[model samples]
Target: MNASRTPLFCDTVLAERIERAEARLMAECCEAAQRGDSPGFVHVLAGGVASFAEDGSPYNKVAGLGFHGVPSAADLDDVEKAFAAHGAVVQVELAHLADPAIGVLLTERGYRLESFENVLGLALDGEYEPVALPGFVIRRSGDDEFEQWLEVVADGAAHPDTQGLPWHEEFPREIYLRAQRHSAAAGEQHYVAVRDGAFVGGAGLRVSEGIAQFAGAATAPAHRRRGVQSALLAARLADARAAGCDVAVITTQPGSKSQQNAQRQGFDLLYTRAVLVKQP
Candidate 1:
C-alpha cells in the first residue's frame, strides 16, 4: 500500500485530479440519494460536502474536504455538529493530498481511524484482453431484472469479508434498490453476470468527465473463484472505453481480494485514504 507521503502518492497534479474525481463521485452519490428520496440529505462544507442518511449508515459522511488544504478548526467543528444534529457518526475520508495536519487534528478531537482504502486506477488507452468464462455470460443489466441484480449484489455484500464495512450490511433491501435506481437514472450503467439463467454477480459503471468509476462490484458466495467478477469487470471496462472514458478507478480495502484482483488487471496503486469516525 502506498502511504500518503510517498512521492508518487503526493504528486500535486495527480492529487488534484484525484481530489476532483472524488468530489464528483461524492456529489453524484448525494444527488442520487436526493433523487431517490433515500432518507439522506447533502450539505456543502468548508472544503467539501457532507451527506447524512437517517439510518446512521457510515456511507453518510463528509468527503472531499481539505483536499487542497486543511480546513479550519472552526469548520471541522461545524461539520461535526451538523453530523451530530442528524444523529449520525462524524466520519471523514481523508485523502493523501489533504493537509497532513488534519489527521492529528481529527485524532485530537476524538476521531479514530477505522480503515484504509486503496484507490486504484487503470488507463483505458490500450486494448483490453477479452475475458472468456465458460458457461457464464456478462452483459448490461436490463430494467426487467433489476431485482435479481440487487439480490445478487446484496448476497455478495453479506460475505464475511465484507461484514462491518460501512454501507455493506447497513443498507436495507429498499435502500439498496433505491441507490441502484438513482445510479441508473444518473446515466450509470449496470452490468450483471449470469450462469444458467441465474444472476450470479453484478457491477456498476459511472462515467463523468472522461473518468469511469467502477463501483458496487460483488459476486455471490456460491460463485466465488469462478471468474464472475473478472468477466463483469471486463464488460464494464469495455463499455467505459467505448463511452470515451480515458481513465477508470475503483476503491477497495487494502490487501483484500478485490484489491489483488484490481492490481492483477493493470490497475496501479494511487493512494490510500483513511476513514475516520467519531461516535455521537
Candidate 2:
C-alpha cells in the first residue's frame, strides 16, 4: 500500500497574508453594520451579497438579527423577541472596550457564547516573502474548472467544525457559482492549485479600492496536511502585489487552528471581536 502523504501547512508569511485578507473583510462588515444595512451586512457575512434580505427566509437566517450593532439591555429583550419570532439566532459584537459583564447577562438569560476571533491586517505596502513549493502547480481557475473547486468545498463541509457555521446549506453553492459570475463581470482573478492536473485547493482574489481580500480557500480531504494551503496563499499574495494592492486583511477565530495557521504565515493580530449568541 502506498503511504499517505503528509499535508503541508503554511509558514509565517503566508499566514500573515491570510489574516491581512481577513481584516479587509471585517472592515467591510463593520462598515455595512454602521450603515444600518441589514441586507448588506448579511451579504458580507455570506462572502458576498447576491440577493438582499429576501423575504420569508427561515430563521431570518438571512438577516442574522441584531448583528448590526450592540443592543441596549432593554433593546436586547426586543431583539431576542424579534429573533424568536423568526426562529433565528441573534448575534451581537462587543468591542475590546465593551464591558465584560455582558457575557454574564447573556449566560444568565440562556444565551450561550458562540465564538471569538482576532481580526488581523497588514499594510498593502508591508513586506512579505514568497515561498516556492516546486512540485505543486497554481494557476487561475476558469469556468470549466469550477466543479473541481466546488468538490473541495463540499468535501471540507463534511467536517462541521471545519466547515464554519453554516449560514445556509445553499449558501456555498450560490457563493461559488455567483463569485465566478461576478468576477467575470468585474474582471477579477479566481485561482486553483493543481498537482499533476488534479485540483488540490483554491482561493478567490478580488482587488477593490487598492486592497485585496482572500475568499473561499479550501483544500481537498486527501490533500490536507500537504503544503497546498500554504502554496495557494503564497500564490495569492504574489497576485495581490502584482495587482498593486496597498494592504491585505482576514478575520479568524482567536484560538482556532485557523488563527495558528495565519500566525504560521506571519499575520499580526489587529484586533479581537466577540460575536455574542443569544437564544431566541
Candidate 3:
C-alpha cells in the first residue's frame, strides 16, 4: 500500500467508462431472468436499458441512459412508456457527470429526486497489502453451495445493518435471493465468509473493461460487527487487482458502514448518483 494519496480524476471519460460497464452489468443481471422460473424482463431504449424483475421491484428501472448519446425528450418518453407498460415506475440512477441536459430532460419530464448512492473507486495501478482474518475463512463459493450462498446473502440483506442510509424500499428476502440467482447466471464470481462451517457473509464481483464492480455483498445479522465483510472486501480487492483491472468501483449508501469500510481500504469517492423516479 502506498502511504501517499492515490491520484484519480473523475473526468467525463472515466465516468463514462464506469457508467457503461455498470449499466451493462445491470442488463446482464436482468438477462439472467430468461432462465429457470424467473420473472424479469429487459428492454433496450435508445442506448440505455430498462429492466423489470417484478412489479414494484427495486430492479425495475432504467439505466445506461445519456451515455451512448444524450437521449431526446422523445427517447425518454419511450423509456417511460416501456416501464409503464409493465406497471413499473420509470427509475434512473443518473450519474452527476452525465450530460447536464439529460438531467434537465428528466426533470422536465417529471422524474423526482428520491435518493442518492455513492460510488467509491480504488486505482489498482500498484500493489495492495494482503488481508486475512483469523476466525474466518474466505474463499470462492463452490457449485454445490449456490443455495447456501444465496440463503446467506438474502438473509443478510433481510437484516441489513442500520449503519447507513436506509433502503428506499423494503424488499422481501425472496427478492434478494432471486437477485443472487440472476447474478450467478450472469457469471458473477461469488465468495463466502465461513465460520465454523457456517456461512456468515457472501459477496460478488464482476469485471468489465478493466474495471471491477463489487457487484453486491451482505453480512449476516448475527455476524454484523465481526469483520467478516471487511475480510471479504480485502480478498476481493486483491483478487480484482490481480485480475488486471485498472480501477475498482463499488456503490454504497451515503455514509454507510460499507462505504466507510471501503474508504479505509484505499477506495475514495469517485462519484455520486442521483436516483430519480417517475411513477407509472
Candidate 4:
C-alpha cells in the first residue's frame, strides 16, 4: 500500500463502469450457455443485454440498462418481443443511479416493481491478505472437480443462510446447475472449500474491465458458521488484485447474509438496482 496514494471510492464514473461490466458479463454468460445443448437466447441492446437461458430459468432477464442514458422505447419493445417469443416475462434490473427517465418509461410500459439487489464494492488498489480457516482447506477448483463443486454450490443455494432478505424465487436444481456451468464457461473462476477431505463450499470469481465480480457462493449445510465463505472471498480478492482489477464487486438480495459478509470484508454499499417485471 502506498502511503501517498489515496484509496478508491465509489463515484458515478466508477459505478457506471462496474454496472456496464456486469451487463457485459451477463450477455457473455447467455452467449456461452446458448452454445450448449440447452440453446438459450441473447438480445444485445445499446444500453444492455436481454437473455433467456431457458424456460423458468433465472437468467431470463434484462440487465445493464439506463446507464447509457435512457433506452429508446423501440429497444424496450424489441426486448419484450424477444422474451414474449418464448412466452417469458421481461424482467429488468435497473440501477438506481441510472437516468430517472428510464424508470418513468418502464412504469408507463406497465413494468411493476419486483425486488431490489444491492451491489457492493471493494477497491483493489491495495494488497489483500489470504483469510485463515482452521481445519478447512481452500483452493481453486479443477475442471475435473466441477461436478463436485456444482453439487456443493447448488445445495448451498437451496438452503441459504437466514441472516437477511430471502431471494425472490428459486430455480430448479437442474436449471441452477446449468446456469453455474454457463457462468464457468464465461470465464468465471471457481474455488472450493474442503473439510476432512469432503467438499464443503464453492464460489466463483470473474474479472472484466478491471472489475472482479464475486459471483454466487455457498457452503454445505454442515459448514455454516465456519470461515469457508470468508476464506473464499479473501482468496478471490487476492487473485483479483493480482489480476490488476481496480475494484471487486458482488450483488445480493438487499440485507442478505451475502451483503453482511461483503460488508464485514470491507466492502461498501455502492449502489442498488430495482428489479422490475412485465409479463407477456
Whole-model Cα lDDT of every candidate shown, in order: 0.73, 0.51, 0.80, 0.85
| Candidate 3 segments exceeding 4 Å error | 37-40
The runs of at least 3 residues in candidate 2 whose Cα sits more than 4 Å from the true structure, single-residue gaps closed, are 1-85, 97-112, 126-130, 160-189
The model with the greatest TM-score is: 4
**TM-score versus the correct structure, for each prediction:** 0.86, 0.59, 0.94, 0.95
Which candidate number maximizes lDDT? 4
RMSD of 3: 1.8
Q: For each candidate in turn, give its C-alpha RMSD to the true structure in angstroms.
A: 4.3, 9.2, 1.8, 2.2
Candidate 1 lDDT (Cα, whole model)?
A: 0.73
Q: How would the candidate models be sorted by TM-score, starting from the highest? A: 4, 3, 1, 2
Q: Where does candidate 4 clash, by residue pair? A: none
Model 3: lDDT of residue 162? 82
For each predicted model, how many residue pairs clash, with residues at least 3 apart or on different chains?
Answer: 0, 27, 0, 0
What digit string (tens of lDDT, one per residue) describes model 4 on residues 222-266? 889787899999999999999999899999988887888887887
In Å, residue 247's CA in model 4 sits off its true spot by: 0.1
Q: Where is the poorest 10-residue window by lDDT in model 4?
A: 1-10
Off by over 4 Å in 1: 1-10, 36-39, 160-175
Cα displacement (Å) at residue 121, model 2: 2.0
**Residue lDDT tens for model 3, 101-205:** 778878888989999998889888877644788888989888799898888888888877788898666777767677677777877898999999999899998
